[model samples]
Target: MFRFFESLIDPYPGAVPETPPRRLLAFLFHYSRPLLPLLLAMTFFAAMVSVVEVMFFAFMGELVDWLAEAKRERFFADHGGRLLGMAALALVAFPLLVLCKSLVTHQSLFGNYPMRVRWLAHRYLLEQSLPFFQDEFAGRVSQKVMQTALAIRETVVKLMDVFVYVVVYFTGALVLVGRSEPWLMAPLLVWLLGYLVLMRVFVPRLKLISMAQADARAHMTGRIVDSYTNIQTLKLFAHTQAEQAYARGAMDGFMETVHRQMRLVTQLTVSLQTLNSLLLVTMAGFAILSWHQSLISLGAIAVAIGLVMRLRMMSDWILWEVAGLFENLGTLQDGINTIAQAQAVSDSPKAQELSVPQGEIRFDKVTFSYEAGPRGMDDGNHAARQANVFDNLSLTLRPGERVGLVGASGAGKSTLVNLLLRFFDIGDGRILIDGQDIATVTQASLRRHIGMVTQDTSLLHRSIRDNIRYGRPEASEEEIIEAARRAHADTFIRQASDPQGRTGYDAHVGERGVKLSGGQRQRIAIARVLLKDAPILVLDEATSALDSEVEAAIQEQFYALMEGKTVIAIAHRLSTIAMLDRLVVMDQGRIIESGTHQELLELGGTYAGLWQRQSGGFLGLEAAADAAPIGAAEGQTRGEGEASVPDRQRQ
Candidate 1:
């Protein structure tokens, strides 16, 4: 009995060898444990309601028989009063019992159960890592969570009601039929056999249909979400028609699957109804034959017919509920699979908390690669080469030293920054801060000492003040403004206003700060980083998106702000890093040159070649102009010396 109940409740157990299909029941039991008492109360009430319903049916049958036998006055005189009183009490009791059951079921199942399950699932989803969101479409995830909760709730409630009622109706009908005419039991057994055989043939098909429907829905949801998120891109490219066609294709596929499943269900339901009707006819025929042979009384025939009808209704309801249960089980399984796949990252039990420290970074021969292959990769390319983004890269930054990194595109510059931030752990070697290996420290703690401003600045759709304060949540308004002033952001911020005429810092930055210009956004990002005031700073093409005039202005401010801070700046523009204390040139994931600007120029190596190519046009012309002036000035000074005595007399 306990195992049966457990199976009904929890559907999924642990991932163990030889686990059964009933594991879904195990999941329900696990989640429902807290609601066990309420469930028990609901179950008790449900059983009482079922019992009353069966009793009501029996009582009605007896009342009909009593009316039919009204000619026997002596029989009525002996038991008429007792029968009337009992019938009256049953009529009242049955409805009262049903009312109580309804209240209890509504309170326990409809109200509390869904709320608790949703809360638990939502909390669990929230705890998942960043990769989970990356892999799933937001619409699909939202749909799954909401529909799964609703499906579970409906399945549980209906299962409870159907199981209890079926048991009571079947048991009561069987006993009554056996007492009146035992031969009726044989037909009941036949009916049960037919129902089971029909279910065996149709249930698997229903599950398949449901699974296919759910897959289609998820695909449609994903397509819709993708289109909505990239709507601006579609509009910019004038691909509105193409996007609409793609969405139409998804919807058409979904509708086709839904129609196919609905047709199948219709056929199955019609066949089941026909079979039930035939069983009813057969039962009625047998009961009439038994009455004619005097094997059963008229009252017994009435009772038998009532029992058969009740049994038929019970069977139909149970079959339909079971079918729905199978359908819901498939949906629940999909949700569970999503959740299981989402648990990709888990912190080690022995992982240690990182103590805050001064900025001192070291990378010791780090190698890293992203996941590859069709299943692992987001892109659907099975033949693509699985290559490492970085290989055996080693570098060190002493406390308070500012270094610049120059690299071409796909040279692992961003990968290096990501590694330093511990977004992804290295495949080999170790990264350390202040002599402590990064892996040993908590991720939150390790990030606390680092401040970064990347090329693509993403600000929340919020007030400018809030976006600035996001860098340091506890920062005061004055401190934020000060940081803004330092990053040269205050002048533009003061000129800005929202649609409502709220000026300066209170202006709304549209989604991803779209309302602001690229330069303004970059400066705001810089201000955010300045407010953070971390010991280590990483600037990855921080000024690349700005125009030259704005870039020059920000660059001048950046130099002053970078003082006394350890900085790692990655940029493709070599001229920007010309003033750095040291520049490191990287190629194919390795540093090829590291030296001062003048020393690298003297070597005339890759760095020098790049520098000359970038600055040759302007610097060469300026040098020639300055050389001509130096020679003329020298000749003038020599002429003055040769004629100095005569020039003094003339004056």
Candidate 2:
């Protein structure tokens, strides 16, 4: 029965949740609509349980009066049947109702509701644009996702279990007291009004405090996780003290919010206790006076006292539930702010799947700027206020063409590659793949045809086989091994063993492949991309991490991989790209020169100047400063100063 209830709702529903409403009730209703039937059943059982509880008190009153008046001999004949029937109802029906309620609340709603909330929320978050993640703390965003799920579950389940039951029980108690003697209802009526007034005053204040508390907790978590994520950097820099101070700032802020929340809770508790005392004293006095006046029976007096005492205990429980409800609501609101955002880089309404049969990429008069930020907003003149990474910049990679991008840091080399991958949308003009506008195509399909290996590679915390096969999930073990071998990663992988004693392909990689060396991670990344075998390949300093010997060996494999694919390679090592079909020199968001390595060297232009300044196959820092401009209008090269290669070698 527990298992049946547990499996009643799908934990990971495929349907996307609708835009969450800002209003608390609306948000609750939106998520609750799917499980409305079960929730309704749970509420019914809860109310029935409350009703049975009230009937028990009513029966107790009747039994007290009967025992006082009935003859001892006839008592069994007269009231035994009634007492036995009540016992059967209490033992059988009441326990069954309570069991059903508990099953739904604990087994079904507790587990499944939060899982669904997280699944839907996580799915929505995945669709958010890259910049959305870049702008926020990964730890904080994740904290919100997790916290929101539990909060929503607690809020809903508590409402069904505690709030609904309390309301029905209280209403029944009021009716029971009034039927016993009209005077008995007055004290309860006054107490109910005062209880509501106190709640109205304290609950809202608690809610506001809870919001601050939740936000503070997430911020503290983010700060701590940030420190942990960059622990190596902190240790290398010997900045442990500084890191502690940074985290301590967030912790102190969280403590302040906690203090404020607890202060409010203390006040609410004191106020509620006072209200409870007045109700108990007033009900007792009224019950005693009614019995003295002979206006109510002895049993009526007993019932009134019993009901009021139960309410006193219940009031405290209700107060806690109500306070918690609002607190969770605050957390839900905080989570919604992070998770319920519109997608910034969604495809067009009529988006089509991109097909790249020819592997031709064209940047047609493209313009882009990271300065205008993710939303692409700018002040005043669009061009004047913004510093563009690319402005009216156009380049093309012909089908199966091997092109290299040469530039210094901040010269838009990586930016151009990012643009090609559509990681960031361009400001003006369109990028097309084989005559189809990239913006009009679905992002997944567009990326499906492109394989890229970045300089900074991060691997998932999974086994070696899993990370390698991520590029092509359906690839067989033999194919994976083959790909690893081609990338020269097989030897290390074969020798690898994690702390858990899993060796070779089964060995787990630590977070972000931290367990592996830089070269090893790069090799694994290369193996994955090789397995992917996309038609359009991008290599951004792909071989930068490997030693000369490994690089030389991998060069042949890269050549094989580049065959029949339109390849764009970015490299600061001039000699590595010296043999490419074309090298485009970029500076300050504009292309200054473009030709084959020999052609550019013969032409004696910026590329030639950069080539001449190479120190041990890598461009010197001085080359970046000196190779800024070309007298292209006059068709003349900049003068090669004393900072040239021969001068540097002698120095």
Scored by TM-score, the top model is 2
Q: lDDT at 185 for candidate 2?
A: 90
Per-residue alpha-carbon lDDT of model 2 for 1-651, expressed as tens digits?
888999999999888555677677777777778888888888889999999999999998898899889999999999999999999999999999989988988888888998898888888788777767877888999999999989988888788778889989999999998998888899999999999998899999899989999999999999998998777789999999999999999999999988888898888889988988998899989988888888888888778889988988989889888989999989999987887776767777799999998989999988776545443555657654445556688888899999998865556677777767777777888899999999889988998899989888889999999999998999999999999999999999999999999999999989889889999999999999999999999998898899999989988999999999999998888888777789998765678889999899899977887777778898774535644453231111111111121211111
| TM-score for each model | 0.78, 0.93
For model 2, the superposed segments whose C-alpha errors exceed 4 Å read 16-23, 371-385, 622-627, 630-651
In the order shown, what is each candidate's alpha-carbon RMSD? 13.5, 5.4
**For model 2, the run of ten residues with the poorest summed lDDT:** 642-651
Each prediction's total of clashing residue pairs, residues at least 3 apart in sequence or on different chains, is 16, 0
Q: How much is 480 displaced in model 2, in angstroms?
A: 1.0
Best by lDDT: 2
Clashes of 1: 16
| Tens-digit lDDT track of model 1 for 336-408 | 6664343433344577776545667889888665543112334655345335555677899888888988654
TM-score of 2: 0.93
